[model samples]
Target: MKLLLTSGGITNNSIYNELVDMLDKPITDSNVLCIPTAMYGHPWVGPGVKAWKFISGKEENPMVNLGWKSVGVLELTALPTIDKDRWVPLVQEIDVLLVSGGDALYLSYWMKQSGLAELLPSLKAVYIGMSAGSMVMAPTVGEYFIGWTPPDDSDEALGLVEFSIFPHLNHESLPGNTLKAAEKWAASLKGPGYAMDDQTAIKVIDDTAEVISEGYWKLFQT
Candidate 1:
C-alpha cells in the first residue's frame, strides 16, 4: 500500500504538495475513508462534518468542488465500543484513511481500541495522518506531552516506525498556554525526541522518514 503522512496540516495552514502527491492518481472516482479520533467533539456535526460532506461529494460542503466521496466514517473511542460485526466488511473498501490531530496518548489508545492498530498497516491504499497522527505512527513518541499522565504506558505508539516525533515545535503564533503545555511535556521525557515546527513534516514512506521543509527539526536518540 502507498502511504502519505502529513504532520498537522499543509503550508502556512497545511502543506499541499505532500498531500496531493500521495494521491498521485486522480481523486474524482476514489474511495476514501476519514476516521477521526474519538477525542474530536462531534462525529458528523459542525465544521468537520461540513467539510466531510463535501469531500464525500454529498453537496453539503463546498469541497465537493474538489473530487471526493466519503465512503466510511469510523470513530474509535475504545477497543470494544463499536459494532465490529458490521465494520469488517466496510473497512476493506477504503482507499485512504486520514487521522487528524489531537493528544498523542489519547489517540493511540483509541486507535488500538478501534481495531485499526491491527488493520491499518496492511491496508492497500493510502494512510494519511496529521499532527499527532504522524507522532503516534512512530514506535515511541519522545517527549510528546509535557503534562501529567502515567509512565510510558501510552507512549509506546504503534511501532509503525522506530523513532520519536514532536509536532508544532516553534510556531510563534500558537497561544502561550499550548506552547507551555508542550514545553512541560518535553521536559518530562526520559529520552530523546524529534521536534517539528509548523510548515514542516517528516514523511515516512518505508521505515525511514525524510524531513521536509523548514522549521525546528531535531532527532534525539537515546
Candidate 2:
C-alpha cells in the first residue's frame, strides 16, 4: 500500500502534488472511500456534526473534497454487521482510502475488528491518513496521544510504519504541541519519530519514505 501520512489533511500544494503523483492519475478520475469511524471515539471531535462535515467535504481538511470520480464512506463500526463480500470488493476497487483524524487507538481497534488491518498489506490503494489516522500506522502512539482505550488498554497500533508521529507541532491552537513537548514525547518512544507541522507530510512507497513539507518538521531518532 502507498502511504501518505499527514499531521493535517492536504493543507498545502506540496502535499497535494505528492498525493497526485502517488495516484498516477488525475484526481477527477479516482474513486475514494473515507473512514470516519475515528471521529466518534474522540471527545472533542466525535459523534456529531464534525463527522458529517468530514464526509460532506465541508471540513477544513481536504480529503473527501478532492474532486474524485466517486466518494463513499466506509464506516468501520458498521462493518461487523455487514457481509464482507459486499464491501471488500468496493475497498479493493477504490483508488484511495481517506482516514480522518481523531482517536488513534479507537481507529486501530475498529480497523482490526473490521478486518481492514489484515487486508492492508496487499491493498493497492493509497492510504491517506490525517493526524490519528497517520499515527495508527505506527507501532504505538505513546501515552501522550492516547485518548480512547481499546479492550486490551494498549497504545499499540497497526505497526505498518517503523516510526511514530507527534502531529500539530507548534500550532497556535494546540499550545501543548510545542517543540519542547514533542521532544519529550519522542523520548518516550522506542524507535524513531517525527514532529511535524500541518504543512508537512510523509510519503511512503514500499520501504522508501520521503518528507514533503511546506512548513517544518524534525526527525528524532532514539
Candidate 3:
C-alpha cells in the first residue's frame, strides 16, 4: 500500500512532490476523492455544524489546489442513506483517496460502517491523509484532540499502518499540543509513534517508510 500521511494538507512543494512520486503519475492525471467526513463530527449542533461545513466548502478545499481534474467529496456517513451501487463504483474509480481532518474516531466509525475500510487495501489509489485523517489510518492513535469520546469498548483505528500518528506537534494555534504533551502520550503507547507538524509527512510504500518534512517532527519509542 502507498500512503502519504500528513499533519496538514499538502502545503508545500516537497509534500506535493512526495505525493506525485507515490502516485507515480502527475496529480492532474489522478482522480481524487476527498473525504471530509471526519470534519462532520464537531460536537456542537447548530453553529458548529455550519462552521465546519463552511470551512469544508469548495473554495477552501485543499484538494482544489492539487490540480486534479476530477476531484469530489464523498461523505462516508451519507453513503448508506444514498445509492450505494452508484457511489461505491465512483469511489472505486478514484486514483487517490484524500481524507481531511476532524474527529478521528468519528471518521473511523463511519468508514467501518460505510465499508470503506474493507475496500481501501485493494484499491489502486494512494491514501493521502491530513491530521485526523492521518491518525485514523494508524493501528491506534495517540490523542491529539478530535472531541469525540469513544465508548469504553471502542477506540480502534483502521490499522492501515502499524504505529499511531500524533499530528500538529507544537503548532502555534494548538497551544495544548506541545512536545511535552506528546512525550507524555507516547510514554503510555504500546509501540513506536511519530509527532509531526504541518510541514511534515510520513511516506510509506509497502515495506519502506520514511519521514519527509519541511518542519520539525520526531519519532517516539517505548
Candidate 4:
C-alpha cells in the first residue's frame, strides 16, 4: 500500500529524497517499471512509436534517469493478447511502478480490462503515479471537465484511496489548470479531494496520506 502520487514526476529534492527513502536502498539498486498505457487515449499520430513519442516526447522520462538499476516500459494495452504469466513476473520484480500521465480514463480502462487494478494491491513495490496516473488511484476521478476526457461514462476509479486527486493545479502550460478551476471541480464531487501542482505530491501508505511538496496545494472537503 505504499504510494507516492504526484502531480508530476520527481521534480525537486523533496520528492527525490522521499522516493529514495521509500526505496530503502541505494537509488541505483532499484528496478523500476514504467507504464505509459494511458497515452493510448490521445489522438494517434502515425505509427505505434510515434503515438508513444507524442505522449512522452518531453525531456528524459523521470523513471529512466532516476538511477534505477534497470527501467522497463510495460505497454498495458498488449496485456489482453499476451500471457499473464510473463508480465506478472516482470511486475513482481520491480521495486517501483511508475505510471505516466495522459488521459485518466484511458489508463483506467486498460487497468480494469487488463486486471492491473486488482493486481497492484498485492504487489510489494512502491506505486508512483504522475498526473493522470495520480488521479486514477483515488476512489473516484470526479468531473475533470478539462483537456482529458472525464473518467468514462460511469466516472469511477480504482478505489485505492478514499478521495480524488486533481493534479497539475496552477500549471501554466496546461490551460484551465488553475486553483479556481480545481476548486470548482472538487466542489462537484461528493467526497474529499486534493488539488496539487507540479511540485506537490500526496504520499499514501494504507489509509494515511501525507502531503509532500515544496510548492502549493489545497485540500477540499464536502
TM-score of model 4 (CA atoms): 0.90
In model 4, how large is the Cα lDDT of residue 114?
A: 84
Ranking by TM-score: 2, 4, 3, 1
Best by TM-score: 2
TM-score of each: 0.71, 0.98, 0.88, 0.90
Ranking by lDDT: 2, 4, 3, 1
Question: On a 0 to 100 scale, what is the lDDT of residue 193 in model 2?
Answer: 94
Whole-model Cα lDDT per candidate? 0.58, 0.93, 0.78, 0.79
Higher-scoring candidate on lDDT, 1 or 3: 3
CA lDDT of 2 in candidate 1?
A: 50
lDDT of 4 by residue, 101-128 (tens): 7777778878988878889988889999
Mark the 10 consecutive residues where model 1 has the least summed lDDT.
Answer: 57-66
- Model 3: pairs clashing at backbone N, Cα or C within 3 Å: none
The numbered model that scores best in lDDT is 2
Residue 119: error of model 3 in Å? 0.6
List where candidate 1 sits over 4 angstroms from the true fold: 12-15, 41-67, 143-154, 173-192, 214-216
Q: How far out, in Å, is residue 61 in model 1?
A: 16
